[model samples]
Target: MYILGIETSCDETSIAIVKDGEEIIENLIFSQIETHKIFGGVVPEVASRLHMEVLNKIFKLAMEKSNLSLKDIDLISVTQGPGLVGALWIGITFAKTLAYALKKPLVGVNHLVGHIFANFLRKDPPNFPFISLVVSGGHTEWILVEDYDRYRLLGKTLDDAAGEAFDKVARLLGLGYPGGPAIEKAAEKGRLIFDFPKIKCERELDISFSGLKTSMLYLIKNLQKEGREIPINDLAFSFQYRVIEELLERSFIALNKFQTSTLVLAGGVVANKYLQKRFSEVSKRENIKLFMPPPILCTDNAAMIASAGYYLYNKGKVDGLDLSADPSLEIF
Candidate 1:
């Protein structure tokens, strides 16, 4: 089956064609990182406008690169929500129009679920009943995946997500935008000297990062008040360490509580080499099967959406032309 996927959930304008959810015939992505870097974050209106401008070009390129015609696509998949509302609408509208024009089956996929399914693209994908730690710029969630369509929300961030905290902290330290990569890069040359407070959630599974971000702010202010030169790399390393440690601690708790042997790391934050290395080390020590997609698949893309849509479509999950963009859509 050929599935054409559209993803404009945030700053990326992506279009992809996937075969059987496993083979990616062509995946094209146009990143707006450079455009958003000046602002130190994404502007919803700008992101939406860029998506509109480049979406058609990306779609055509995907088709051309794959050497496939519109008629060859059997299903249309799109990221429907939990993202910038304007950005979500652009992809949803384009997808709805294409599905309507082609009379193809349409599936509006949850962006987070699409992240989880990115693992399916891996040659050695994890089996059913796995624990997924989804950490990204906009979200931090723990999910229990019993099957392709069966997902239970195990826990989530109560305030700022891990990626949001990273961005906020990075900005505080004069680091550039898209904080995960920036912090990771700075952390490479530093040591974990600063002792940032760790996060403690009221609920066992729920997590919070607002407190951690606040702590970092206070620390920086105190250092500045003392007329001391801030150790940017050390601060970055310490902050990243605390953040990754919290995630790892929670993931271990979830694995034990749910009795799941396999652990899947999803979303853009998983692209951080430090996080990946730590998770690899711990998962091996604890004898847990860990699965993570490559950096290309970790970020917002259409291939994962297409891969997810293939399974959702087969399970009789289809949407009508009236499908609307849901910015706050949740994966269940």
Candidate 2:
């Protein structure tokens, strides 16, 4: 079965064609990062309008690239929640209208669940009954994946997400928007000198980055007070190191407790080279199989949504015309 997927849950407007959930025939993404960089964050209204303007073009491109028309698509799937309400609505409505018009099945998928499916796109997909760490600009969560459509949320951030913290710190440093790549590029040339805080939060699965972000801010301001300008690379390095350390530490705890051999990562923050390196080292040491999607799949995209939706569709889970976006959609 061929599934046409649409994703506009945030700044990215993407479309993909997936055959039987595993094969990606065509995946196209239109990013508004450059446009929203000036603001150092995404403006929900701007993102929604951009989706309206570009979704059609992206749809056309996906069809052309896949060499398939609407008639060839067997189902339509779209991200329906856990994102900007306006942006989610655009994709949901577009997909619903198309599905209704074509009289085809429509499936609404959770954005974070889509992120988890990103693992399957990897060369070696991890099996179920494993732990997944989903860290991104908007969310930070540890999930126990028992099987397809079965997610047990172990814990999550109480304040700022890891990626959001990175963006905030990067903006304060005049690094750029989409802070992950910006800080990563700068960190490559420098070493960690500043002693950043890594909040463990009592050895539980829960983690916190709010304190870490504040610590970075104060350290930078204090350096400036001493009439000193810290090298951007060193600052970036310190920030990345502290964040990766906390993430890996908590993930390892989960791995040991769950007795799972697989450690998987998903979401935009998974693109961090430092995080990837740390996860690789720890997984190797613990002899746990690690699965991480390539950078392209790490960020938001329709391919992951389609891949996840394929499983749901096969299970007879389809959305009706009355389906609406759930901004705080919970994964079960």
TM-score of each: 0.98, 0.97
- Residues 1-332 of candidate 2 have per-residue lDDT tens digits of 99998999999999999888878898899999888987768999999999999998999988998888889999998999999999999999999999989889999999999999877754456888999999999889999999887889998898899899988888877888888888999999989788886586764989888888888788878989999977889989988888888889889889888889898899999988888888999899889999998899999999999988988888779989998999999997
Residues 84-142 of candidate 1: C-alpha lDDT, one tens digit per residue: 99999999999999999999889999999999999998566789999999999988999
Given candidate 2, what's the lDDT at residue 39? 74
List per-prediction Cα lDDT, in the order shown: 0.92, 0.89
The TM-score measured for candidate 2 stands at: 0.97
CA shift at 205, candidate 1, in angstroms?
Answer: 1.5
lDDT of 1 at 91: 94
Model 1 TM-score is 0.98
Candidate 1 segments whose C-alpha is farther than 4 A from its true place: none
CA RMSD, predictions in order: 0.9, 1.3
